[model samples]
Target: MSAEVDRGNLRSRIGMGDVLVVMVGRVGEAALVTGECEGWNIARTVGRVSLAEAAPVNPEWLATWLNSSYARQWCLSRAKATTLQVTLNLAALRELPVPVPPLPQAREFLRLMAVMEEKAQVDADIVRTVPAVADAWFRAETAGGWLPTSRFGELVRIGGGSRMRPHPEGAQPGPAGYAGPSVPVVAPADILQSELAHLARTGTEQEAAADVPLCPPGSLLVAVREDGVRVVVNDVAVALGRGVLVLEPESEDDRYWLLHAIRCHAADLASTAQGAGGREISHRAFAAAAVPWPPVDVRARFAEVAGRLHRRARTAAEEVGTLAALREVLLDEFLAGGSRTSRGSSPAHGPSVRGEGVQESLFGMR
Candidate 1:
């Protein structure tokens, strides 16, 4: 609520400088209203906070603070929770204390955040655009059923079936009486979480022996979920865990071709997944699926283009991760004034944003 808001005219139409807060489910998720979305209508479960035109606080800065971990806990603490959902009322949101710096300092803080946010948006766009482009190329080359087809099993070797050990450490054991080097373990969750057509790393690694199912770099990892068949080209050597299948291509040319081929037929392959869970892919059904096998030279041509697009996608995904981490770090630093910060470091004992030399170094401000 602001002094300028008319009581009768406060409709759902959003305005610039309005902060949209989720009132249900995710409770505290908030975003700043920009010019692009200024006139959009908000749902009933959303609460809009409008600021007077002469308000000293920046809307983006307020929105950023609302989305921080501290504010999340604050909102959740006051929200009414049931087994199914959590709901925050307007009164709780109105009581949230916001720390405001001078307009120029707040704007400077936001400028750095905006730079990282824009870079991340660009990378996210690449991750989404690459798959469509690659899929189009696949359809164009394989159109009209002109290329001779082959069973999927014949084109590549399928590998999987290493189970996770029941040990407390969650490590995967090898054949008895064997000890060897460790490699990152790819699981169903890893494949499902990957946004692009490539996977750069996994969260956990296990000691692998000679008998463990090992997928070398450049192999396609597939995870059949309830939604569809998820796939990614692993850029590093990784050991496979249960529910993760590896498709090993014989050459570099076959790599991208098989990658896109599996993506284009994701729905058909997912149809084979049948069980009580309906999330597991039947090996027999997958082995018999028809795949378009074009000439090696034609595949090489598609590979040359698709491969470049996927590689760029992977690079962009990596940058997205880096930018996200840095943004979180900056948010924690900015929001925590003289108290200990999330990274376990504190600014020189004074105001967090003003007149502190450390602020200049942290935000890259001159």
Candidate 2:
């Protein structure tokens, strides 16, 4: 029930605890709202789904179960694809079934999931705070001295990768016939908020060598047309796809400062983008953008601080990835009836099961 009304229209409202299933654009996507969003109109494409309650049956437990791999697979299997997008209608979604585990078992699963979620949130907080700390450090240290400004082109070499041509024989040696180690090819997706550690690539060394030009480690990679200006340090040699731009600093010591500067001014850089099909910042425009050019000593100091923050952020991201993998494994084991305890053991350290006769029902309604 919503307290607020607009022009006598009863808005489709969802509150802090509502769980919504995306029915159209991103079919089968489920999100649990942790914040309140009252009097908000939900589009027809999204369905508000809930489970019916019986004694000792927790809603949070049911919602978590619905978002697990078991439910995701069921939803994916039933979704219908059209030319534009895939969709799962309300009727079809309602028919998807979930296992009715005993109440104690469901609660135990929720407890394990809660532990993972808590750790994820802590890691996420670290990832979010590190950049802001870097930004603040830059602002504070540069406030005393009036630094001279210079065009980005004067300080760095900016270039795009050559367009790749796929070969008939997959993963063969390069044009030079050099059969070295296979290099990871980077697309826009490889550039995360603060790092570029993942890449999409052909498995064969030959395929990687043929067309992709390698950008050396420490080069700053930027995604031009994306909504958020994503920039990251390339830790390894990588070939860039079309959507990416590589910025190589004249002095390697300036790399950390340059990365932080670009991140701080990402919105401004994104605004200068221009193109027809999709907006993109050209090499020329990107190079010509003005940047604060502080003294070498000041930049070095900032770089030292920024490097520490970057390392911490990287560690947090790795921890989050590890926890997510563990959570997935736990969910798989629980759903498969292979685990009687939350920690994957028998009655030793796990929660004791009770209320075996509890009734369970999964309800899908708008």
Q: What is the lDDT of residue 336 in candidate 1?
A: 58
Q: Residue 355 of model 1: what lDDT?
A: 15
Candidate 1, residue 69: the lDDT equals 62
Name the 10 consecutive residues with the lowest summed lDDT in model 2.
344-353
lDDT of 1 by residue, 55-159 (tens): 546578768877766677778889997655678887777777666666676787799988888989999999889888999999999889888999878988876
Looking at model 1, residue 168 earns an lDDT score of: 23
lDDT against true structure, model 2: 0.65
Q: What is the lDDT of residue 222 in candidate 2?
A: 83
The estimated TM-scores of all candidates read: 0.68, 0.73
Per-candidate alpha-carbon RMSD to the true structure: 9.0, 6.8
Q: Which candidate achieves the best TM-score against the true structure?
A: 2
Give stretches of model 2 more than 4 Å off: 1-11, 15-17, 23-27, 43-45, 54-58, 73-92, 161-209, 224-228, 250-252, 339-366
